[model samples]
Each structure stands twice: as structure tokens, then as C-alpha cells.
Target: MRILISGASVAGPVLAYWLTRHGFSVTVVERAPALRKTGGHAVDLFRPAMDISEKMDVLPRIEELATGANRMTVHPESARRPVRADLTKIFSAASDRHVEIMRDDLSEIYYDATLGDVEYVFGDSITAISPDGEVRFENAAPRRFDLVVGADGLHSNVRRLVFGEESRFSTFIGAYLGVLTLPNTAGLDRELLIHVGVGRTAGMYGAPHLGDARALFLFRSERELDYHYRDVRRQKEFLREAFAGMHADVDHWLDELDRTPAFYFDSITQLRMDTWSQGRVTLVGDAGYCPGPAVGGSTTLGVVGAYVLAGELARADGDHERAFPAYERAMAEHVRASRGVALSAAKTLIPTSRLGVSGLAQGARLVSALPAGLSRAFLRLTTKSARLYNSMTIDDYPPSPAASSGRVGLGVE
Candidate 1:
């Protein structure tokens, strides 16, 4: 059977990798002309995702490229002194073994790992997807495959094509987030700085590679703003208008945003679908069940979903009828918990009032000064609330019968 997977980020490439190993021909189609270098934010890969990576033999390579932050500093936008955030406490609060990496880095790793075996069609997308698994390309002739998977991100073209529409499954989470690379102003020594104020928060952190820094802007909004996703120029102007009069290098960052070639802006939204599969076409990762961006579990969910889909397909000998439903059943509860945690965390982390910023800073200070043992205890306590958002290890899924199969065909058919 031949599978055409959309999106080349975490889900598509990983799914292609596994499907190729499972005796199925796999091809990945990405909208970007090449491997996407710009990632919206850094994502955490918990135990389950990491286990998947290790099984793929990319865990050691990931560790070699790990960018470990020493501490996180929280500050009021009006103040200069920052309250140091405890690194130990933050990591411990997660109930899973976690590895933090930039989204693009992970994408690159997956792309490179599967380049030899998987067919990658760049600068293309699906304009139409038939119920019988025929894919119409935006820039190429129509093609047919036994199975089609949408591993695309939040605003997925495949999901829109296969399903009725994206709005039906999308739920706005009352927040907006923007992230982009900028000049390092705070001279951070592997520390992340988060500034908070009334209904707004901005964060700056040094990246893992290239001495450059990246900035994150988040704000609480109950109403939708007229924003264009493709126009980066307008997005910069919107950001400046939102934060017109701010202190501590606000305009400087805005100026940098105007010049930076890599910038990302989006509202916090999750796709909640009743079913991930329609006939032979299925959606994976954000296209199906986005647990919200930058709130954890998104990457892990993608990895676990890919692992299960591939395993189930192999278990059923490429029969998607038996595979898709089982894949959904295995991941449904975990997806619900992860999405709920993301919604809840966004409400808690982003301050609602000016005073709330100060409160959050004090809390960070307290956590930073807590004893090591107490810090671990607090992490354990908070992690339960996070559930699979914090713990995403797939130790339960044993070695599949498909594991022995190798050198599967990746022909387009």
C-alpha cells in the first residue's frame, strides 16, 4: 500500500519513517519549498515522544543537540529586576522524562533521518482529497494512494479538504501568541526571561544554536482580531500597535521584528474533532487534535499518534479499516486530557491584571528558593494536573510484529 502524508514537520516525517519500516510505500508532501527552518516556538518532548525517538535511533542525536536552560527569569514589564525561576522545579513538575528542543530542529532531524527511504515532495499541498483516497495537488497532477494522512499543522489544507471545514473543529482558546528571532538584549546566560503586565506577557530566551535570541509575545484576548496569517509585515505592525508604549527595549524588539525574516504569529487554538479518520484519509497531530501550541504535549501527541497509526497499520497488514479506529481509541482519552491541560495552562500562565503579574513573579521567586526535595514534591503535585501533557511515554505499546520488517518500498505507485 502507498501512503501520502501531508506536512513535513513532526508528524509527517515521523509517520513516513514508521510506515516505510512497516512494509508500506510512503511519500511526504510539504508546502514549504524546502525543509522549514523557522519554528514558532521551542517544544518539549516528554517520555513517550522521546521513547519513540530512541526507537527510531534519533534520541542520542537529540541529546547531543539538547539546549538545556539553566533557569527562567520572570519579571514585570515595568520592573528591571527579574525573579529567578527554579529549573529543577519546572522540570520536576512534569511527571514524565522530558527533552526540550526547538521545533525546527526536531523537524530537521526527522527529515534527515528519513530522506534516504521516504519520498519527499516539497513546495506542494493537497487542494482536494477524495473519500476514496485520491489526492489533488495544488501544483501537480492528481495522485491516488491507498491511505492519506494529514500531519499538517493547525491550519491544515488536508483537513480542510478531507473534512467539511477547519472551523468546525477549531476552538479558540482566548489568547494570542507571537514568536520570532531577535537580538539578545538581556545578555541571557542560557536563561529565559518572561515579562508580564495587564493581559500581556513577553518573553525572551536564548536559543540552543547560533548565539541569537528569540522573543515570545502573548496576550489575552476574548475577541478575534483582524489578522492576516501570510502577511508578516502586517503582523509586525499589529504587534507594535498592541504594545505601543512599553518599557525596556519594547520598540527595539519591534524594530527587530520588522527586520527578522523568520517570524510566527497565531492565536491559541485547538482542533477538537469527533473522529480523526474519514474512510482512508486520517488526520494526525495538530490537524486532528491540536492540544494548543507551546503549552506542552503537542509534540508528544504527534509522536504517539504517528507511532500508533503506523503500528496499527502494520498490525492489520495495511488495512486502514482495522487500523484507523484502533488508533483513535488508543489515543482519544490522552488527547482529551492533553487539550484540557493546554486550555487550563494558558489561563493560568498568562496574567489577567497588572497585579497578577507581580503575583506571578513572587510565585516564581518562591519556587526558585524552595528546597530541592520540596521542589521535586511540588513538581510531582503539579504534574498530576498536567496528566499526559507532562507525561507522554509509550512504554505500554510493546514491540510490534512489523518491527522485523525492513527496507519497505516507498514507491509513489
Candidate 2:
């Protein structure tokens, strides 16, 4: 069984790793000339994802690279005195096991882990994918494989080629997220500073290991904004307008707009499809069913989805006819639960009114102020969605003899 996976960032490499371990030949294609090293922000991985990483022997590196953001200061726009919050307590209440790591770091860890075992092609992309596994690339000779998977992110090229335009299956979550990289500001080494207000919020944080920091913006909008995904100039203009008079500190942060090394902006949207598979191709992670962008536990979803898809293929003896359906079945509940939790998180984090903003700030203060035992219990009761990732249980699948030798046509592991 030979497999070709698209989008080498998070899920693509992970899926490739597991497939090779199951004795399949694997090749990964990435659009970036090399690993992307820009516009990354912190992403959380909960219990289930932690378990999977442990099985792959990458958890220790993940922990070593944790953002260590354990404290936060909230500056409410209403002139309320800033409130201090303990992130350690909030995360402990969210899950028994969790780590907040930079997206770029996480992607690199997985890519490095799978490097030797898989064939990775960078600086190229899939121009077309046929129903029978014939793939055409922009600068490489066409090749055919037994199966092709799209592990690409939100605007997956593979998804567009196979499943049609994204709007056909996307639902905007009434919000947008932007991130910028600049010299350290506000917080450092596990510290976070927030400027929160009704319908919009901004923050800056840095880690001791990083020479620079990141500025994050999350805001609510009644409708989608106008801008092309590739137009950096237009995106920067919109970002300036959105936070024009936010605060002196925010303006200071925005001053780096022209000089920042990297910037990221996108709508927080969800992908809902009746099915992720048709013929020999299927989708995984954000490419297939993104719960929602920043607010969603998309990092964890991507990890778990890749693991299950690989296990199913091995168990079915490389028969995607049997594997794809089983893979979807195993992940259905977790994906559904994650979507609900993400929606709630987006609304709560970026409130719709002044009162809502105060309540959100006070709620954080209350959670961090209580006794450890009491705070954990209170959080579990009032914020059940916070334990959203804890509700999932990982299934174990060992390498199998039933898997094909993978040397029939394309010689592989």
C-alpha cells in the first residue's frame, strides 16, 4: 500500500508517520519551500492528544517546548483596574494533562520525528487528484498511489480540488483571529497581558526561549469582512482599522505592523461536510472537519484524527474501502463535542456586550482566587466545556502483521 499525503504541517506528517509504522510506503507533499517558521501562536493539546504523542515518543520534547504561559493580567476597556489571573489553575481545571505549545514548534517536532522514515517533498503542491489515485504536481512528474489523504488546513487545495469550493461546506463562526510577530512586549516567560473589551480583545506575550513575542487579536463580527486570503497589504490595513483606538499599548504593538517578521489573519470558520470521503481520497484534520479555528481544539483534533485514520487502514489490511468509513465512525463523537466547545469558547472569550466583558473578567478572577481544590471543583461544574478534551478517550492500536508488505508496485517499508 503506497500513500501520498498533502499539507506537511501538522496532520500530514503525523498521518505519514503512522502509516509507515503500519508498513505502508508514505510520501508527503508540502507547499512551503521548507517548514513554515512564521505567524505561529500558542495552541493547546489536551489529554487525548497528549496520550497519542506519548505513544509516539514525542511528548517529552513537546513539554520541553511548552510556552509556559501561566499568568495573565486583564485590562478591561471600561477603566476597571486590571485583574490578575492564575493560568496554572485555569488549565489544571481544564484537563488532567495539557500543554500550550507554539504551533510552529509542534509542527517541527512531528516533522522531525517522521523525517527519516518518510519521503518529504517541499516547495511543491498538488495541482490535481484523480478519483483513482493519479496525482499531478506543479513541478514534479505525475504519480499514482493506492490512497491520497488531505491533511491540509482550513483552505486546503486538495479539498477544493476534490470536494469543490470551501464555502459549500463552511460556516463562519462570527469572528476573526489575527496574530503578529514583534520584539518582546507586555509579558515574558509564562506571563500574558490582555486588553479586553466588548466584542474585541488583544494581548501580547513572549517566552524566555523566544527573542520576539506575538500579538493576538480575537474579535466578533456580525458578518464576514472583505479581503482576499493572499493580500497581505489589504489584511494589514484592516487590522489597523480594527484596533485603531484600542489603547496606547495596542497602538504601540501595531507600530510593528510594517516591520514585523510575519503576520497571520483569517476568519474563525467551521467545516461541516456530510462525508469526508469519495472514491480513493479522503480528508483529515482541519481540511476535512475544522471545528473552528483559534477557539477550537483543532491541534488535538488533528492529532487524534491522524492516529485513527492510520490505525484503521492498517487494521483493514490497507483496504480504504473498509478503513475510511471506520475512521469516520471512530472520530464522529469527538469532533461533534469539540465543535460545541469551540462555539462556546469563542462567544465567552469575545463577549457581545459591556456586561459580558465584566462577567468574563470576573469569572477568570474568581477561578484563580479560590483554594486549589475548591477552584478545580467549581470550574468542573460551571465550565464543563473547559473539560471538553478530557471527555475523550484514546483507543490503542499496535502495528499489525495483517498490513500489506507495501512493495507490490511502489517499494515501501
Candidate 3:
């Protein structure tokens, strides 16, 4: 079977790799002229996602690029001084195996792994999909595939083309997030310095290999903010208003917003769909059932989802009729758990009250102050409530040589 996957970020390339490994021909379509260089925020890969990466023989490289953000200094609203925390210990207790890699780095690793074996069509996007499996592209000629999967991000073109408007399935969870890339003037090395204010939080961090440091901002909003997602100017204004007078450091970080090289802002929204599949086309990763962005463990979910979707397709011998439903059944519990986690994080991580801000500080102190054994125990206890990514298991699907049919774009485009 020949499969075409849209959005060659995390899930698209992952699915393409596994599908071809299972002997099915695969092609990936990306709208960008080339790979994305946004250097997105750091993303966590828990035990299960790490296991998937290991099986692909890319774990070492992934670890090579891991963001060594091992320490945190938080200045809470009510606190007179900064409270320091050991992020290394907190991470160790959170999962048996974990790696926090920059999002763009992880995407590049996955994309590079599938280079020669997979067909990649950059600078084009899917415009339409017919029930008979005919996919129309904006730049390339129309092509037919046995299956089509949407691995695009939250603002997915594939999802919109198939499902109705995103608002129908998207729920605003009363929060917003912004990130900017600027010079690492604070001289933070493997450290995250943050200010925790009522209903908002701001941080700046940098890695050794990074040429510029990144400033992160998160805040709670009772109602959706009035601004277009593509309006960068409005986003900067809103972020400024939210974090105005937060602290000298944060104010300094915000001051560089106008000159930053790359900027990203979006609502911490969740997608709740009755079903991710319709006929011959189905959705995967954020394009389908994104629990939420930053706080949602979405990167892990996307990797695991791609692995499962590919495994199911191969297991059913390219029979998507069987594979699609099984894939949904497999991911249902994980999705539900992650959604709950996102909702909780929206309030906890970005506190809405002074009391919540203090709790956030005390919780960090407790984590850093505890012994190794006790810390892991406490983390496990707290994680049982928010650590669905670690508990979820990825089913094994060894490659089937008999599963592949024909190849597409074998030589050149």
C-alpha cells in the first residue's frame, strides 16, 4: 500500500519511516519550503516515547541534542527571594527514562532518519482529499494513495479540509503561551530563571550550543484574547500587557521582543473530536487529537501515536478499515489521561492566584530538598495524577516483508 502523510514534522516522518520499514511505500508532504527552523520550545519524551525512539535507533542522537536545563530559579510573587530547584532530580523521579530535546532538533532527527527511503514533497500541501483516496496538492500533481494521515500541527490544513472548522472540535482552556528567541544576555547556562506572578509566568534559558537564548511566557485568561493568531504585533502587545512590570529580568526579556529573530504565540487549546477518522483519511498527532500544546505532553503523544498508527496499519496488512479503529482504541485512554493533565497544568503551572503561586514555589523546594529515594517516591505519587505518558505502553509491530506493495517517487520528483 502507498500512504501519503501530511505535515513532515514529528508524526509525519515517523509514520513514513515505520510504514516503509513495514514494506509499504510512503510519501510525506510538507507545506514549508524546507524543514522548519523555529527551534521550538523544549519537549519531553517519557519512557514510552523514548522506547519508540530507541527502537528506531535514533535515541543516541536524540540524547545528543537533549536540552540540559537541569536547574531552575523561581521568583514567586509573594516570596522575597528566589527559590532554587534541581530540575535534574525532578526529571529523574518523573520517569524512568526521559529526555528533554528542543522541538526542532527532535523533528530534524526524525526527518533525517527517513530521508532516502521515503518520498518527501516539500513546498506543497494537500488541498483536497476524495473518498476514493485521490489527494490534490497545491503544487504537485494529484496522486492516489491507499491511505492519508494528517500529522500537521494544531492549525492543520488536512484537518480543516476534512473536518469542519477547528473551533467545532477545539476548546479554549483559558490560557495562552508565548515564546521568543533572543540573545542570551542573562548568561544562563543549563539553567531556567523564571518569575512566577499571579496568572502569569516568564522564564529565560539557554543551552551551550544555542546561539540565542529563549524566553518563555505563560498566562491564564478567562476568555479568549481578541487577536488573530498570525498577528505577531498583537501577540507582542498582549504578552507585554500580561507580563508588564513582572520583574527587571522579565521586563528585559520582553523588551527584546520587537527584535527577536523568531516568535511564537498560541492559545493553550485542546482538540476534542468524536472520531479522528472519516472514510479513507484519518488524522494523527496534533492534527487529530492534540490534548493541548506546551503543558499537554503532546510531543510524546505524537511520537507514540505515529508508531501505533504505523504498527496497526502493518499489522492489518494495509487494511486501514481495521487499522484506523484499532489505532483509536489503542490511544483512547492515553488521550483522555493527557487531556486531564493539560487542564490541570493550565491552572497549576500558570497560577491564577497568589496562593497557587506560593504552592508552586513550595512544591519546587520540596522536590529539591527531598532525598533521591523519597523524591522519586513523591514524584511517582504526584505523577500518578499527571504522568500518563510514562504509564502508557507502545505495542510492538515487527516489520512484515510481505506487507509492502509498490514504491512512489523512487528516483526523483
Candidate 4:
């Protein structure tokens, strides 16, 4: 059997790793020219994703590069007072079984691990996917496959071609987010400092390696402002306008935003799909069910989803008819739980009102005073109330194969 997968970042490569192990030929196509080395968003690997990584033997290396900043300071921008909350207290509020790592580094590691076995076509994308399992690439010739999967992001071309317009499934949460790399001018040492107020929040923290700093900007917006996704100048203007006349390093952040080539901005949108599989083609990760930027479980969901997919395929052998629905059954409840957490986390963490922030601060102080074991227990219960958040158990998925399918023809444009 052969499979064609789109988007190499997280789910694509991971699915390749497992499907190849199960003796299926696999090829992955990425829009980026190479393994992406930019973007510094911090990602946490929960239990199942971590376990999958351990089985893949990449967990230790991931830990070597993991960020260790466990304390976060929530400050009132109006009063300039630091809220006394540790990192665990501020970020998770209720969970303890998470490991944080930079998104780009994780992508690089996953890509490297799959390079020897998975065929990768970079700087290309699919223009159309026919039910006959034929893939037409924008920059390549068409090729027929046994199965096709869309692991592309929110704006997925594969999904658009096969599933219909994205407008049918995407729901907009009331917010916007922008992340960019900034020079370590503040001289932070493994700490995340957040300043929140007036429906806007900005924070800068040192890179785990102390190399440079990363600035994160988030705000609640009721209206959608027009801007180009690829136009940096326009994006900078939106950032400037939203933050105009605001306190706390607005001028310096605006200057840094203009110079940073890796700036990433997007709306907090979620994907609500009733089914992830269509004919022989399927969907995984954010392409099918993004809980939005509001949810921090994207990485975890992607990793766990890949593992479950592989296991189902192995159990069902070559029959996608049985495998696809089985994969959904195994993961649907978990998806719903993870999505719920993503929907609610941002609103609570970035507290919309002064009283909310104060109550959060007081709660953190109370939690911090507990003993080690007690603190861990309290966190497990209070944070991430979702039952499926980290409750992944890798079933009997076979190991990934050593040989890849190489590049297949995508019908010419």
C-alpha cells in the first residue's frame, strides 16, 4: 500500500513514521523550501506524545533542548506591580504533566528522525486530489496513490480541494495573536514575564538557552481588521494601531516587530469537523480539528493523533474503510476534551478584567505554599480538567519502515 501526506511539520512526518513501520510506502510534501528552522512558539508534549517520542527514541534529545523556565510573572501594566506567581501556577493553572519546547526545534527534530525513511518534497503543494487517489501538485506532475492525508495547517489546500471551502468548518474565537523573535535587550534569565491589561497582553522571555528573547503579543478583538497574511508592512501597521498609546515598551516592540523576519500572526480560529476521513483520504492534526490558538494542546493532539492513526491502520491491515473510522473512534473523545481546554484556557490565563487577574494571583499564592507532592496532586486535579488531555496510551502500532516511497507525480498545473 502507498500513502501521500501533506504538510511535514508535525502530523505528516509522524504518520509517515508509523505507516512506514506498518509496511506502507509513504511520501510527504511540504510547502516550505526545507525543514523550517524559524518560529519560536513554545510547545508542550503531554503524556501520549511524549511516550510516542520515547518509543521513537527522540525524547531524550528533545529533553536536552527543552525550555526549563518554570516561573512566570503576571504583572499589572497599569500599576507596574509583579503578580507573585510561578511559571507552573500562571501557565497551566491546573496541569502538571507537560513538557515545553520551542516549536521550530521540535519540527526540526521530528523531520530529522524521519529523513532517512520518509520521502520529502519541499517547496510544493497539492492543487487537487481526485477520489481515484490521484494527487496533483502545484509544481509537479500527478501521481496516483492508495491513500492521501491532509496534515496541513488551518488553511489547508488538501482539505479545500477534497472537503470543500474552509468557511464551512472554521469558527472564529474572539481574539488575535502575534509572535516574533526579539533581541534579549531586557536581559531575562529563563523567566517568562507577562504584562496584561485593557484587553491586551504583551510579554517577553529569554530563550531557554539564553541566546535571545521572544516577544508575544495577544489581544481580544470584536471586529475583524483587513490585512494580508504575507504582507509584513501591513501586519506591522495592524500591530502598531492595536497597541497605539499603550504603556510598556510599545515603541521598542514596534521597532523589533518591523525588523523580525520570522513574525507570525493569525486569528484565533478553530476547526469543527464532523468527520476526519473522506473516501481514501483522511485528515489529522490542526487541518481537521484545530481548537484554535486559544488552545495550547495542538502539539499534543498532533502527536497523539498520529500514534492512534498508525495503530488503527496496523490493526485493520490494508483496509482504510475499517481503519479510518476506528482511528476517529479512538481519538474523538480526546479531541473534544483537548478542544474544550484550548477554548477556555486563553480567556482564563489572560484574564479580561482587573478583578479576574487579582483572583488569579491570590489563587497562585495559595497553591505555591503547598508541599511538593501536594502541589503536584493539586495541579493534576485543578488544571486541565479534561479527562483525555494527557491520557494517551499507544496501542500495538508496528514500527516505521526504513525505506520511503520517494516523490510521486502530481498532475501538472
Clashes of 4: 15
**How do the residues 338-380 of candidate 4 rate in per-residue lDDT, one tens digit apiece?**
7677766777666678876665565666676666566656666
Instruction: Locate the minimum summed-lDDT window of 10 residues in model 2.
Output: 404-413
TM-score of model 4 relative to the true fold? 0.91
Instruction: Write candidate 3's Cα lDDT for 1-413 as tens digits.
Output: 67889998898988888888888788899999999998578888888889988999999999888888899999997578999999998888778788988889999999999989999999999999988888899988998887889999898898899998999999999889999999988788899998998899998889887877899999988899999878999999999999988888888999898898899999999999999999888999999889888888999899999999989987887777888999999999998888998888777789888898998888888988999789888877775433576578768998765654443222212
lDDT of each: 0.78, 0.87, 0.87, 0.76
The residue pairs that clash in candidate 3, if any, are 23-404
The RMSD of every model to the true structure, in order and in angstroms, is: 2.6, 2.0, 2.6, 3.8
Error in Å for residue 48 of model 4: 1.5
Model 1 error, position 409 (Å): 13
The order by descending lDDT is 2, 3, 1, 4
Per-candidate clash tally: 3, 1, 1, 15
**Predicted structure 2: lDDT:** 0.87
Candidate 2 residue-wise lDDT, 1-413, digit = tens: 78899998899888988988888889999999999998699999888889989988999999999998899988888674999999999889767899999999999999998978999999999999877678999999999888889998989998999989999999999998989999885547688888888889999988777778999989888899988899988988877877889899899988998999999999999999888988889999999999998888999999999999999988888878899999999999888888898898898888888897888888889989988888888887876465677778767878886544443233222
Select the stronger candidate by lDDT from 1 and 4: 1
